[model samples]
Target: MADRDSLIADFLSRTAWAGARRAPLAGDASNRRYERLTDPATGRTAVLMDAPPVKGEDVRPFVRIAQFLRGAGLSAPEIFAEDTVYGFLLLEDLGDDLFARVLERRPDLENSLYEAGIDVLAALHAVDPPDLPSYDPALMSELAALAFDKYRSGVVGDANDGIRAEFVARFRQLLEHAATPERPVLIQRDYHAENLLWLPERSGPARVGLLDFQDAMLGHPAYDLVSLLQDARRDVPPAIETAMIDRFVTRTGADRAAFLPAYAVLGAQRNLRILGVFARLGMEHGKPHYVDLIPRVWRLLQHDLDHPALDPVATLLRAALPEPTPDNLQRLKRQ
Candidate 1:
């Protein structure tokens, strides 16, 4: 810890924010920690990202994607200074107007804020993506299995490995069949309200500030849209979700028939992955609070499964995983 502090001090010392006052910021599920750095004299502020390399966190993907998004006219933070080797970055502080916070304070602005965010996705999808790994069926299927392996297994003594293998094989087939493999768009895997900032002063899609995009990968356009609408952290009103889906389809000229199914599949895949992740975070990582969010995630999963496109896999999931009842939730927390 002392060595890390010295590294942070030295990194800031060489930069324009030398001797800046620092205050810790709330971190996400990842190992990365952030701090707000304020210049004592000028009062200017920048965000300090302290991603320890020892924890297997890398800053290169973030730097690369931030530059790409900014170049594409979106509001990804500007990189002020970086120490790739030590995994520290001085970034533009986009401020406290996160979409979730703004909506909580001013519920009336919900529609406009959500619309702008959807517009950003449309704009991003219109362009050709940079070189990045594909969030392919194989990878996605593997991740979705975490639902059975972690969440289900943790809740109900043990899951049948044989059933898990069968589900994954069938789920992968569904994914492969539904996906438009030829047309891939850059998807910010965690593109939801919590990661979005409402910068109303800026015009068009630029009004939405982007964050937590280091895991961006090439996937179906509907993937990020699912992440946006079926959020686990906060409830996006059903009316708003429907209207935004219409808005995105209109803007992007996507076939409603083809798009809706892909949206459902992606949502199912993402929510299933979250179930496993939340369970693992509580049971193994000692972050039990995430277990409280399981009910919302389970609701979203059920909604996704109700879609006719997921009929084949829905029964399998339902039979395999137990419901997140109050008792089941307690079981997770107790772990």
Candidate 2:
């Protein structure tokens, strides 16, 4: 704690707003923390990201991806100053109009806000993607298995190793055959309402400000779309989801038939991963509030499983993974 505080102090001392007043900001699921820096004299505000390297957090990727998004004419926060070695970044404050909050205040703007986000994706896909690790079928399937390995085991008794192995084998084959797109594009693995901000004054794609994309990877285009629609944090109306999917397909000139199934496959993969991740957060990481969101994640996973393209492993998933009933969710929280 002492070292981190000193490092933060040293990092700020070298920046333009050396004596800025700092107020803590709500952090995400990662080890990183953030603070809003207010210039005492001018009331100018900026964000300070404190990502400690010892805790497995890195700021380099955020810096790289932020610059890339800005160069592409989107609204990723501008880097005001950085200390990559100590993992601190002084960033332009994009303000507090997150999509989730905006929709809460003005429910009527849901469609337009969602459309702007879809447009950003379309514009990004049209360009050559950055050099990054691939979110390939093999890696995705391993992550999907977290539903069985973590959630199922935590809720029920430990999952049978044989059953878990059998599911992973089948699921991997399903993803390899059905989910692999011929050409992959950059996917902000966590794109969703909460990570998006409504910047109405900015025109076109810039109207949607991006955040939390340091873990970006090269993956199927449907991957991020699934992240946006099947979000774990909040409910997106079915009408809005359908319309946005159609809009993305139309704008990108993708065949609806091929895209729908891939969309379903990736949706299932992502929701399954979320199920495990949420459970693990409570069971192991002491953040039990995440367990409260499991029922919603389960509902989203079921929606994805209904698509015929997911038939190969859907039955096994249904059989092996217990539903997030009130009792089962309580079990996870107790762990």
Candidate 3:
């Protein structure tokens, strides 16, 4: 704890947050760390992001996406200051009411909140602005590959090799289900129960504060919808999911018949990817709590497999993947 505090202090000192009264904000799996600081000059609260440059991740992408979202008039975190070299940034505080906190405090409000969320997603997907970049299929494939590399191959036991094979084979087929030319939109890959926040100060969809948007991209409209509806961490009610999907299709002017299969496949794909991520986070990252989320996500995959609209893709998942069994049962239990 002391070491982390020292690191935070040193990071703030060398970056834009120097001389501010810095305190740690909860950090995420990414290398970024955030702190709440008092801006000495303005005497206002500021959000400090410690984005150390290491590995393949860079801070510039975060800055770039923030700029793009802001240009689109999306409610993104505002950059208050920056240190080009060490890659620390001072941003405006969105608020403490992350969707997670809101869910915890007012579980009953989910239906209304999700309705607003779909509206935000509709707005984001509707934009074809010149500044935003695309999230091509190549990136989607790579992200999906993480499941095979990190979770299925490494975490699933040798006894369940066939079960592992089933998932991988089906995962490939699932990828094929939603494979399409890129669409233009701001896609926050990790949009889910945690990233969307409630801001009563604002109205309707704008009332939701967006976060962890550095990975935002121009991708399939299905991507963000799947991320929101088939969330691994929480069970979004089927009725609500159905209503919201209908609303999104209407709101975004997407063809209902043409889009349903795409949405289902993408949702299944998102759920499956999270399964692997949860396993990887457990075994490799030593964050085992994520393992508990695996079964729920798998259930979602199964749901997609059963979706009549997604029969082609569902057939693939069913064919490539074996029925659940003790061989797979023990593996599932291990998670």
Candidate 4:
């Protein structure tokens, strides 16, 4: 703790705002932490990102992506100073108007905010993404399998070995069918309402400020779109979701036939992963509120499974995992 405090002090002392007043900022699921620092003399504020390397956190990806987004004329935070050795960054504070917060205060702005987010995705997909890991079928299937391994097993106990194997095979096939897209684009793996900021005064895609993008990867463009529209934490109106889908398809000239199936498959994969993640957070990490969100995630998963292309995988999953009823949710929470 002493070393960390000293490092933060040294990092700030070297900057022009030497004695900034620092206050805690909300953190994400990762090991990283953030503080809002206010320069007393100038009354200007910046965000201090504390990503300690010892906890397997690195700031390089964030730095690289911030530069990339800014260069591309997007609204990623500007880096003012960085101490890579200790993994501390002083960043331009993008302000408190996160899209989620804005929506909570002004429901009327929901349509514009969501549309701006969609436009950001469309603009980002149009560019050639930086070199990153491929979100391939093998990887996607592995991630989705977490649902069975953690949530199903923890909530309903283990399944028969034969059934598990069959489920794995069916799930992998569905992922392969969806992941192999003709035009893969850079996917901000966590592009959702919570990670997006509403910068309405700005024009075009820049009207949306990007956050929490260290996990960006090379994947089908539909992956990020699904992440935004099918958010587990918030209920996006179905009409807005449909309209945005139409807008993206028309704007990008994407084949509706191909894109819709890919969207469904990726949505299923992502929601499945969330089920496992939420379960793990509750059971292993003592964060039980995440368990409350499973039913919602399950509903989203079922919606994706309704797609004809996902029938085989959906059948296997429905047979394997028990319905997420009140009793089942209670069992999961108990874990």
Candidate 5:
């Protein structure tokens, strides 16, 4: 494939591409491949995505959500064209800069970046959305089940499957207690720094461009916030996280009396799910980068659980994790 210089030309000819060449880009969690195309016709560069739907890499939802989001004045990648069945997409190029890259260069920019992210999220949540298939209750249940299947699948040791049972039972209790707001909104499920591209143009309100939004859904608002504040790849400063939350509260004008507890509970719920996923990725998917994040994620999980606002979940994980010991995790990691 490396020697196949004409592959891009052939693909473009097959797709009637106006681009000069195709440059492949790396991906995560999906079998789909991406190539940046420089089309001469219309003098526009677009992204060419090849998703083998047979391999469960459908691109329709991404298309639909992007359309709907753009209608709402958001800067989702615009679709230039598509081949639905074969799973090919021509998308408006959003430049090479990503939010992760922005943060790496300017640590002092976090405050503004986080504020802009939260503001956009608030607008999305304020849409008074139409009914759409959501992952609210579904995700809550699935996360519990995942903890059992992945974490307690005899992978982490003394805990075993029994620990899964305990976690699920407690998770159920937490879900039923917190649940979600009946008023749902389109959730950019993976709206973290990495999925955001910093585009200063058309950047007045939406300072960042959205990516990997095929997983968008009508769901809980806090889920996305948790993803940002407790980012998997970066440690968002505590002050930054607090300021973002405050800005969200102020912009929405939601009752403070109700916001803190629910946010804490959702934060706790989400981190627990991520913990299981981290372990599962290492043991099942053979991915080690996710494994390294386990300790940091564990600390975040405990930090949220320990919050008085989320006393119940905090109590549960504290009981589950116990007095921290090198041996406990070392032995548990074996399971």
Candidate 6:
């Protein structure tokens, strides 16, 4: 802890923010931490990102992606200074106008905010994505299994090795069949409301400030779209969700037939993964509040499963996992 404090002090000093007032900012699930640094004389503020290397966190991806997004004319934060050795970055503070916060204060702006969010995806999918890791079926399937291995197993106890094998085989087969995209695009793996900022002052896609994109990958465009519309943290109105989908399809000229199935498949995969993640967070990580969101995620999962294309995966999951009943949720939370 002393070393971390010293490193932060050195980083700020080198960045010419030695006398700034630093206040803690809420952190996400990762090991990274952030601070809002205010210059006393100038009263200007910047964000300090501290991703310590010892915790397996790296600032390089965030730096690289920030440059890419800015070059692409998006509203990623501007990099001011970086200390890659200690994993600290001083960035232009994008302010706190996060989509979730804005909507909470002004429900009337919900539709327009969501439209901008969808437009950002449309613009992103229209271009050739940067070189990144592939979000392929094999990798996706492996991630999806976390639900069964961590969440489900935590709830119902471990399944025998043979049953687990069958479960994985069925899951992978269904995902492989449904993941056919005519042209894959860069997917901001966590493109939900929480990660998006409402920068109405900026123009076009730039009005939507992007955040938490270090895990961007090459994948079907529908993956990020699904993430935005089927958010686990907030209830997106069905009409707004439908309008955004139509807008994206129109703007990108995506084949509705192909895109819809891909959307459903990816949605199912993502929501299922979240179920496992939330369960693991509660059971293994001792963050029990995450369990409260499982019912909402399960509803989204069921919605995706309603698509005929995902019947096999849905059937298997339905048979294997318990419903998010009060009792079941209570039991999982206690774990």
The CA lDDT of each predicted structure is 0.93, 0.92, 0.70, 0.87, 0.70, 0.87
Root-mean-square deviation (CA) per prediction:
1.1, 1.0, 4.1, 1.5, 3.6, 1.4
User: Residues 108-179, candidate 6, lDDT per residue (tens digit)?
Assistant: 999999889888888887778788988988788878777778777877787445655676787678767777
Candidate 2, residues 1-335, lDDT tens digits: the string is: 55988999998899887899999999999999999999999999999999999899889999999999999999999999999888999999999999999999999999999999999999999888899999988898889888988899998778678877887788788888777888889999999999999999999999999999999999999999999998899999999999999999999998888899999999999999999999999999999999999999999999988999999888988998998888999998898
Candidate 4 stretches greater than 4 Å from native: 159-161
Q: In candidate 1, how many Å is residue 86 off?
A: 0.6
Q: Would you estimate the TM-scores of all the predictions?
A: 0.98, 0.98, 0.82, 0.96, 0.86, 0.97
> Best by lDDT, which number?
1
Deviation in angstroms for 161 in model 4? 4.6
For model 3, what is the C-alpha lDDT against the true structure?
0.70
| Location of the lowest summed lDDT over 10 successive residues in candidate 4 | 159-168
C-alpha lDDT (0 to 100) for residue 187 of candidate 3: 76
Query: lDDT per residue, candidate 3, 1-335, as tens digits?
Result: 24545655666676655788877899887777888888778877879888766534567777887777666667778886676456677787887888767878899988878888898888776667445566654445455545555555544443244544554565456555554634556678888878887877877567777788887766677778888888888888899899999999889888777587777767766765676677677766767667667778778888876766556445544544433343543454454
lDDT value, residue 55 of candidate 2: 92
* The 10-residue segment with the lowest total lDDT in model 5: 1-10
* Clash totals, every prediction: 0, 0, 1, 0, 8, 0
lDDT of 5: 0.70
lDDT of 4: 0.87
What is the C-alpha local distance difference test score of candidate 2? 0.92
**Stronger candidate by TM-score (3 vs 6):** 6
TM-score of 3: 0.82
TM-score of candidate 6 against the unseen true structure: 0.97
Which pairs, if any, clash in model 5?
Answer: 18-39, 18-40, 19-38, 19-39, 20-38, 155-335, 156-335, 157-335
**How many clashing residue pairs are found in candidate 1?**
0
- Quote model 4's TM-score: 0.96
Model 5, span 151-208: residue lDDT tens: 4442434344565566666666666566466566777768889888877676654777
